[model samples]
Target chain A: MSYGFVAPYTALVIAFGVLPALYAVFLAFTDNEGGFAGIANFTKVVSDFRFLPAVAHVALYLVIWLVALVVLVSFLAVVVHAVRVRWLSRTLRFVFYLPGALAGASSVLLWLFVLDPTASPVSGLLHLLGFSSFVQVIVPANLPPVFAIIAFWTGAGGWIVIMYGALNNISPDVIEAARIDGATAVQIARRIQLPMLRKWISYMGIMSLAAGTQLFVEPQLLSQASNAIVPNDYSLNQLAYQYAFQQNDFNGAAAISLLLLVIALALSAVFVTRGGLFEKD
Target chain B: MTTVDVGRPARRRNPARRRNSVSGWSMRTIIAVVVAIFVLFFVIPIVWLLLATTKSAHALIVDNPFQPGSFGDLAANWDQLFGFQDGAVTSWVGNSALYALGALVITLVASIPAGYAMALTEFRFRRLLLVLTLIVMLIPNTALVLPIFLELNVVGLIGSPLSVILPMAFFPFGVYLTYIYFNTSVPRDLLAAARLDGCTEFQVFTRVALPLAAPIVALVAFFSFVQNWNNFFLPFVMLPSSEGYPIQVGLTSLLASTPAFNPSSAGAQSVQLPTLALATVISVLPVLIVFLFAQRFLVAGMTAGGTKE
Candidate 1:
């Protein structure tokens, strides 16, 4: 009976999730002719001229994005939670989450105009910063911060909402006890509320780190918008894509993906175990 | 979960309340100002995008970016957008709806029962299955897209709609959500009671457990819909033809045709800024509408993973 209930989904996961993952591992270890090539694919992928830069770009972008998500989403969620007016708090959450509707590919598409100094609503601000065209704003040096901003615009709001909910779950009795002990609102927030949120904060960090490592759509579209001024291989995922499609190197593509899969799964395992993500009370 | 106070205003105005050493009024002002500033940062881009549809391409670049253009220009942009590739925008939207809805059905049917079984039943290898789901859930879909594409190609399923739908339906997050919901919320003794009353396990699930799972179902459904609707990479890799493109992929073609982005590719059939912006607005409208109506479920879905007991 239990198997009857679970079989359909398990089958799909095995077919789609487990099979493709195993296939990637197999492809990574084999050459084009299907003979065993061992670590050659991994070595070849790493030796590619574009590999290191793609790694650096993704690393830089991940740091910026993860830090911003932690600091800003927590700050906004705490502040929004503090709002006394119900309607105002709800409205703030709503507005913050509005960008989430235009996520990924679409958000990146819309932001081309936003970053274009000639057509942006904040063109005056752009001009003040000495960016006169879209190209100036989307330079390789600026891609990390630029992608971070687009990501935060569409992604951070969901975190804020999640963080706000976590905040709401804090017992009133504990806060009241702190207040009775002469803790100020600031002290309560810093020492009490923030401490209680440690589990949630770590959860956010691990998850965001995983997601940030897979940054593809933003840079891919930006590379297109900039006429490939931003390198075609601006991210690791894009590199994997180029290997598979452009160079017809499935083994290299599979190797890059397997490397990424290992990192993501390892991080998740650490968090799930140490962070008590699935622990029953 | 503990019920926290929301700091109601009426309670703050009470004379008996202890005055803080720090100035509370000034703190309130700072928080309000900071939140307001962030709000402006978020709203400005969307407002500009919305207003861009009303302006001509020339005016969009020349005039004040915030200035509203005439409805006439908006209508003209609309006409041009729908007229492109003989009304391809409508077809792309239709395709998105079909794919999203199709995948959503599979997600619901698969995730709900699987979650129930994992959370409630004593099954062999349940722990293994749960761990696999978590690992698969964490593995970014982009990383899997290429491998899945290769797999589909081997079976000659590439370029077929099933190529897109089958992969998107493999939503582990939904299973995780339903699992959590049943584990934390559903009462075990109640199931036991039903079982003792001569109801079969499946019957107990369908009658007693499933009805109580409505909120979780809605939460899972909304998330599945949003994810399926917004997914770009899977469909982009699988379907090579432009006619099979969803709106998200179709927007890329529109972007390439815009001379502002692609000067070399622009021809007589090039997309102008206004029409391009209009098309973007059209693409996002369905999700926006669903979001407005489903805010409650959206909140539940976002918070589900974080607020565990």
Candidate 2:
């Protein structure tokens, strides 16, 4: 009966999720003409000129994204918790979350207008910074950080909420006891809360790393919007997308995807071992 | 879970304790400034989006970009957006609704029961199932698109709605959340009592557990809906025609035709910035509205996996 209850979801997972992943692994070893090439496709994909640069671009973007997200979300969560003002905290959470409501493509498009100096609401700030054009604003040196900002805008709020929930789960008795022992709010956050949040933060870090490596929509759409001046092969996922869709190299795409899957699997291993995500409660 | 007692003694001492522990004025000022900056960071782009929708393309480029334009201009922008490609925006919106809702139903039906079974039953390969779900949940959706596309193509389902809907239904995060919910919140004693009363396992779940799982159900439904609705890569790869696009993909096509994004497009002359902004606004409105209404459940859903018993 219990097996019967689990049957439908298991079937769906096997059919759609597991089977496709296995198929992807199989496809990665085969050539375009369906010949089993025995790692030739992997070798070719790794040596593709755009592959290394795309990897480097995503690596830089991930650093900026991880740092900004952790700092901002932790800071906001601590401050919002300390303030203890109900309405203010709720409103801030909602406002931060508003961008998440416009998550995938919409957030990317919104940032395009925001980054365009002539069409942006922050045009005054852009002028002050000596950015008179979209090209000036989105220069090569600024692309990673700019992408980080966009990703942060759309991604940070949900993490903030999760961090806040973690903070809330901390027994107030511990906080009160610390307060009685003359610990300031900052000290309490640094000494107690931050240490307590180690697991959640690790979880955040691992998940963000996995997601950041697959950065696609923002860079892809930005490249499209900027008339390809932004470089269409701006990230690993985009490179895979380009190979599969544009060049009709499905094998190369599968190989690149397999690389990303390995990375994801490595990160998940780290998360499970270090973050204790699946420990028996 | 010790509820922080903030009633009499703690409330009476909090102000004094706060002042003594931290310089109240300076700390308050610092918090205010930091929060204000973050608020502006989050709010400015959205506010700009709203204001940008009201202006003409020329005004969007030439006028004070932050300032509001007339409702008359807004109406004109609406007309241009609806009039583009002979009302294709409407079809895109309808397609999005159909796909999102269809996937939402399937996700709820499949994920909820699966989660319930994992939590409540001693099943074969239970640990394997749980671990697999976590791993699949962690893998980026984009990574699977190529293989799913190939599979769909092999089956001649490319350009069909099932290509999108069927894949969207396999939401592992939903299953994980529901698993956590049932594991932590649904008591074992209740199920045992139902079993003692001669209820079968399915009957215990349906009659006893389902009613108590409303919050988790809502949480799963809201997330699955948003994910399916905002999903771009899968549909973009699977659905080949503009006629089948969800609003997110359709907006990209509109962007391709807009002069602001693509100067070389022949349709660029007809599509304007305001119209594009309006299309963006229209595309996101449903998710925003859902978020506004179902935020309580969303917050609960997002945090469910984080909290340990």
Candidate 3:
């Protein structure tokens, strides 16, 4: 029976997880430039045009996504803990998490309408201010940030909900004791409550890190509204995509994906071992 | 595993002086302002989606937006969406449901038993097995997309629904969740007592542990279902044929192909923006409905392992 239970999980991991991971890594080392050229694929991936920009795009996205989630979740969590309005707090948490349920493609589509100058109400306001064309509202340089805004709209809520749940882990008496010590609300939170929740915050950060690196869905969809102007090889995942899907270069795609995997694994290992990602300190 | 740490509240302090402080008022004002801005950002997209779907492709851009509700235009636009490409979107939705439901069933069967075995049995390599699961979880799902596709291609299962569904079924998150839930939530002493009563291990698990695993059963079901249902990338890659496309992919393909489907502003990209908007609106309805029913279970069940018990 134990073997029976293990059978399905084992088969799946081997067929879909372990085998693929090993095969992809091996593929990355090969030069399947139309056919096999052995180790040339890895060399090409490292030296490819737009490689640095791809890395930079992911780096920039990570910085913005992590900062936004940390700042927003912590702030909202602090406010909820201070106010203690049960129903209102629950409602707000619901509103924040609802966006997460929407898929990335859907969120991107939603933003396209909101950003459309001719139809958007804000664009109407912009028109009244003599800014008619979308070019007035957004330019090429600011486009990635606009995509990041769409991501935050859909993701920041789930983190805030996580923070709320984490805050509940803090004992009520502790907050009261800090109050008795004449510590201000800000002082109590920063000095007392915040320290207690560091492990959770770390886990969220690490999880966010893994998520931020996989920035394919947003950029892919956004490129449509932006008229494919977001640069086809803008991010590593997108570059891999354009290679495999657009150019039919599966070897190059596998190569870049392996690089992404290494980066993700390194970050996740740090959290898993020391940041209390799955256990209490 | 029951912590039962109900620390009492600190003693009362005077309240009259607290209400008059400027810091309190200003902080409240700041919070209110932030809430207003953030909530508006959240609300606008959904409202725009709803409103955009209600208007015809032409009226969406040409008209002065946000007029009173047009039940007529919504019905008409939906009729066109389904009838647009001979109702392909409906087939896509059906395909998505089949894949998500298939994966969800397999995830439950595989993960629940794995969780139970990991928690209860004194099996060899338990620690090694646990570490393996953790490492697997760390390996980002997207990074493995290429390798999985290759594996499927080698086995010639690329276009099959099983290609996507089989992969989605191995949810490490679900396994880890069950591990933690079983570790903390269940009464291990009850199992020991059942053994003392001459009950076999399987009987103890089936009779006592399984029934009490209610909350987690629901939690895993919801997460597994949602992840599979909302998944776009794997299906997009595996199912080369549009016939096997899920709703999310179907919607995206429709959005991508919309400019040709409609001739509005053939010269400009902005003209077809509402097509994308309508696709977004239709994609979220199922998840939203499922979430409303399952959210309470999600919150309570999540509190166990996710927050370190």
lDDT of 2 by residue, B1-309 (tens): 234564446656777775664676787787789889999999988888999899988889888767899999999999889888898999999999999999889888898989998887887899898888877887777767877887677789999998999899899889888899899889999999999999988899899999998988888888889989999888888999999999999888888887766788855336788888888899999999988877577667766665473
RMSD in angstroms, all models? 4.3, 4.0, 5.0
Q: Listing candidates in order, what is each one's chain A TM-score? A: 0.96, 0.95, 0.90
Q: Candidate 2: which pairs clash?
A: none
The C-alpha stretches of model 1 lying farther than 4 A from their native spots are A279-281, B1-30, B306-309
lDDT tens digits by residue: candidate 2, A18-70: 88888889889988778889999888988999989998999999999999988
Cα deviation in Å at residue A202, candidate 1?
A: 1.2
Ranking 1 against 2 by DockQ, winner: 1
Look at candidate 3 and give me any clashing residue pairs. none
Least lDDT summed over 10 consecutive residues: which range in candidate 3 chain A? Answer: A272-281
lDDT of 1 at B80: 86
Clashes per candidate (backbone, < 3 Å) = 0, 0, 0
lDDT of 1 at B204: 90
Model 1 per-residue lDDT at B6: 36
- lDDT string for model 3 (B1-309, tens) is 232232222222446445535676897798879987787777766766778777776787777676543878777666666764677878988898899899999999888878877776666666666766776776667777877887678789989989999999989778777888788778778889998999876788788888988878888898888888888778878888888899887866666665622333354332244545666677788887887776565565444445443
- State candidate 2's TM-score: 0.93
> What lDDT is reached at residue B27 by model 2?
77
